[model samples]
Target: MADDDDLLGELLRFKLEAAGHDVTIVEDGQSALQAARSGKHDLMVLDSMMPVLSGPQVLRALTEEGSALPVVMLTARKGQDDVLDALSAGARDYLTKPFIPDELVARVNTILKNEGNRVASADH
Candidate 1:
């Protein structure tokens, strides 16, 4: 997870860890991109507005590198265009700022569940 805000990062880290997913918190986009490239994580929760590379930039890089890891973009910009832009850039989901933690968790769970089904089916 990459969030410039320390509190938000910590909260998300705790929530995810409690859900049995190991979480890594980074304050900037550069480290997040580096970590993503290492392919060490099952998914990435990115703040759309961040220092160094920005969420859209990171998403574009991941897409170009063929990293299929699911990404959920969090942003204060709730405009329809903004959401569409994130989706077009390969974000699996988008959440506006000040969102409920439960909503975030539910969305993450849904995405992971779908992904798990896809992988299991493919293995058959």
Candidate 2:
């Protein structure tokens, strides 16, 4: 997760880890982009308002580099245009701030399940 707020990131990290996922928390987009490029994570949850590169910028960079890693963007921007911009920038899903943790977890699980299914089908 790329979030400048340590508390929020820690909360998310705890949740993901408790659910049996290895979580890495980065305070800025630069580190997040580096970690993503290293191909070490199965998925990424990014905060759109982070410093250094910003979420959309990181997403664009990843896409331009041909990385297929799925990214979920979190932002306080709830406007339609902001959400559309995130999707256009290659976010697999977008979540606004103050969202329910359970909802976020459910979305993450759904994305992972769907991705797993795709890989399984592709191998057939």
Stretch of 10 with least lDDT, candidate 1: 12-21
Candidate 2 residues lying further than 4 Å off, grouped into runs, are none
Q: What TM-score, over all chains together, does every model reach?
A: 0.95, 0.96
Per-residue lDDT of model 2, residues 1-124, tens digit only: 8999999988898888877789999999999999999889989999888889998899999999988899999888799998998898789999999988777888888998899999999999
lDDT of each: 0.90, 0.90
Residue-level lDDT for 23 in candidate 1: 90
| Local lDDT at 73 for model 2 | 91
Clash count (model 1, backbone only): 0
Report the lDDT tens digits of candidate 1 across residue range 33-86.
998988788899999889999988899999998889999998888989989988
